[model samples]
Target chain A: MRGIFSDGPRTALTAFYWAFLLYLLLPLTLMMAMSFKDASFVAFPIGNWTLDWYGKVMQDKQFLDACLYSVMIAAASMVAATTLGTWIAMLIVAEGIRGRMIIFALACLPAVVPGMISAISLRIFISTIDMPTGTAAIILGHTVHAVPFVVVMALTRLRSMPGNLVDAARDLGADNVVAFFRVTLPYLGPALLGGMIFCVLLSIDDFVRTFFLGGYRPTLPMLIFAKVQGGMSPEINAMATIVLVVTAAVGLYAEYMTRRARTR
Target chain B: MEPVVQFDQINKSYGKHVAVDNLNLSIEGGKFVTLLGPSGCGKSTSLRMLGGFETPTSGRILLSGKDVTRVPPNKRNVNIVFQDYALFPHMNVAKNIAFGLELKGLDNQRIHRRVSELLELVQLQDYAHRLPAELSGGQRQRVALMRALAPDPDVLLLDEPLSALDAKLRQQMQIELKAIQEKTGKTFMFVTHDQEEALTMSDTIVVMNKGRIEQMGDPDTLYGRPGSVFVANFIGETNLLRSTVLGVEGDTASLNWNGITITANQGGLTPKPGEHLYVVLRPESIHCSVTEPATGNRIKGKIRQRVFKGNHTSLSVDVGDGTLLNALVHPSDVAQLSGEDIWVGWKAETSTVIPDRQAHN
Candidate 1:
């Protein structure tokens, strides 16, 4: 009792950190656990465990199509966001342009703006252009929302890098392009990888952006949102479980790679 | 000798602040020239201009008699080892050395050979596989040097390359750098604030002050014949006494410093009587004795304090007019004068007179 009370504030802070962690992970953990429930309905404290919901979700044609469309759209968005973000970061940092801070702030504004606001604005803007509202619209919205984050992350990494390395390479007979490729790009490797991974996950996890823009085809997030609104189901639990597992794996991999890079 | 690099009235300014002002200099081929100055004196700026990292605002830079003012750094046949060494963190020592060769599109075998040879030259043959973080500061500096020299550039620019090393390592590297420059015979333009480093390593030293060249000459000439009071005070420790020229006799001049009369050898500059002047005396040149020497300017003073250095002892002698003159005596001779009345004197040749036209008041 004395030990517990003597370290009261520190113990409280440690408890608070663990509580925050639990709060963050609770919904996903509950969804994963419910996915293995034998019952048809999703609920707490499963009496039995089974893979029937996983089988059902896999067998459903609509779910399968939505899964395919989500994968394709997310992959396309990830590629576009990463490429555009990396180019913009390099331009702002390495090119020594005027008003760099302003440009950087503008580039990062999309990520800080509310996703629903961005989605609605983008939806109205794209509608005036008479563009389709399916995978293309979803991809556009996700890319816009995710690219800013990628740019910010990439720019932070690029700015921390020693500019003298590039200058050294130039002094060593390397042309601008050669120096960038041989020196700058290689040094940006881990940051680029981490940015790409985060961009992909952000694209996949985004629901508000996909909701307004996804026309006929449903992204995984949109489908999940719809399923959750219609009431809990074992199939939705199974899908959420898969997403949680994949996101955790990717996050762990990114953390590992970034740490390894820092050691180097 | 023909000039390998020349700056013709080069001037650089940012907005209204002048960094290098109408600077003109020429470097002969196969000579080691050091730009020596204190911080903010524009020596580094001059080196950067030579390396094509900076462009003169209103003048031209020439290399081997060809105009290269607008040439890019990569196109210029000059390489620079930055002050921080700037080794690629991702690359191993061998790869770092070979980076320049690879940029030149050199063949693989030749790149390998050159890298191995340079590794041997810098005495880092066994550490080729280690990353820069794994190596010590001096080893990283060597790798940077090897990388800069791998392309066999016509000129090498070193921006205080040894400034980052420890004292012992810096001393060792000073010798190593001189040896390397001699072997390669590349026109080396180095910049440093260290007086000893500049004097020990440079074939010629260009002293700069306030964005302009103060003087440029061989180390001996620069040390012996400083053109201005700033140069005289900067290059070595000198006691610059404010004096007034009383009269001139042939090449020697009689000067009065606060009513004390002294004589010094006059260079070509002749000052009229009552003109303000400075009598520059090196500490080692001033001798302290219990009795005045037979023939030279002598001043009676009392020892204010004594500092015991390793090989010599320095004494602060107060010559009664709110002025303290420093005299260095050999440790063997220190026993003769400690807190005692003594006569401090220097030969006329050992002292030079600098007119107070732009001298610090």
Candidate 2:
């Protein structure tokens, strides 16, 4: 018993780190437990345990449709953000020092501001332009908001690479396009996957932005919010548990990809 | 034949700091030429311009009698072996060598053959499937060389390619590089700061100083007849004697070194009387003796220190007036000499006079 905790010195920083982790996880753990309770309402101490809510969520058309829309939006956002972000990162890093500073500042404006204000501003801009609000609009919003993260990730990886690798590629008879695809892109694989996973998560879990930008077709989080208006229900817990499982699966896949890219 | 590469007054600058200034240099065809200089002397900058990795701020570049000043690196017919052996960390040895061939749109069979041939050329045929990270430093260097060479470029530029090797391995690679140059007979443009490596490998040496070419000649000519005090000091160990020129004869310059009259070969540098100059003498050329009976170019001093080298002995003599003379003599000669008075002398043909320039400071 002593040997297990004795491995670490139990310093203040380590204690604080575990404490913050517990604070983040306790609420989610309680929600997951309530999903399995066979009660009419949600509670921590359960008299009966069953998977009735989870079974009901699977058959509910509204919940299934919301889940389908969320998956589509998140997938679309992942592709768009990762592609555009990688290109922008390369362009910014290759620019002169002053140019890099200005461009980076402009790109990070959304991230520095509060998400609600940015989302509402984006909604106003879109409505003013007469563009329809739908899953596509939500995907666009998520992509714009997630681009800064992807750019930062790609920039970090590109910066860590040896400066002469690109030059060496050109010297070996590869043109600019070929050199980038062959040398630069390979090094950015792990970073791109990481950015892509984060974008997927952001698009799925985003609530305020989806409420402002999404059209008649609602996403899973919007549906969950609507269901929670009256009171807490086990069906909401069921949907949350499903989303959690999906997120964990995607995260595991991303970890596998990052490890594979690192080996090559 | 036209020279393989030419830089016509090429100038490269970063903002206000000029990296290369009006560099007018031409590399002759099918010769091993070395651009020898210390770091920040613009040798690497000149090489980079030739490789088209960096554009000249002004002036033009030519290759095969055609202007290629604005051409990108891949569009040029030259390849460079980078200093740190920039092999793609993700590729195997075979793939690395085949990179250029594939870029040229060659078919798979041809690329495979070319990769195999280059692997055998660099003697790494057994390690074709191994990645660059798995190879040793010297092995990776050879892979970089073979990868650049597989393109069959007109000129191969190497930027300090052997600097990352151990001393003995560096020496071995120097001989192999020279042998490869001979076998292929490509116009090789090499860069290095090690004077001994330059002398050992280059058929023509271009000594650079502060963004300008100081001297260009064969190794023997560059060593024996340096044009300026900088060249003389940069190429090898030398004993510099400050003197005022009394006058110039046809091929000989007469100077007074602290009231001791000395005549040396001018080597085409003409200086008028009462002008400051320097007499450049090699340490090995000056023989040391105990007695004062010397024939030519002799100086008297007391032996301050004696060092026994492998094949020669070096003596440090204080010849008064805060001037110290370094002389290399036979190792057997130090057996009979002690802290007594000695004489240092060299033949007239081995020493030359160069005009003194204070701008070097």
DockQ of each: 0.78, 0.60
Clashes of each: 0, 0
Candidate 1 predicts chain B with a TM-score of 0.96
- Considering only chain B, report the TM-score of model 2: 0.95
What lDDT tens digits, residue by residue, belong to model 2 across residues B248-317? 8888888899888878888778878998889998898887777764477788888887777789888788
What TM-score would candidate 2 get against the native?
0.90
Off by over 4 Å in 2: A1-18, A47-53, A96-98, A252-256, A259-264, B12-18, B245-255, B266-276, B306-313, B329-332, B358-361
State how far residue B193 of model 1 sits from its true place (Å): 1.8
In candidate 2, position A110 carries an lDDT of 63
- Where is model 1 more than 4 Å wrong at Cα? A1-15, A52-65, A94-96, A225-231, B246-251, B268-275, B359-361
Predictions: Cα RMSD each: 2.6, 3.5
- Evaluated on chain A only, model 2 obtains a TM-score of 0.89
Per-candidate TM-score against the hidden true structure = 0.93, 0.90
Here, model 1's chain A TM-score works out at 0.91
lDDT at B155, model 1: 84
True lDDT of residue B311, candidate 2: 94
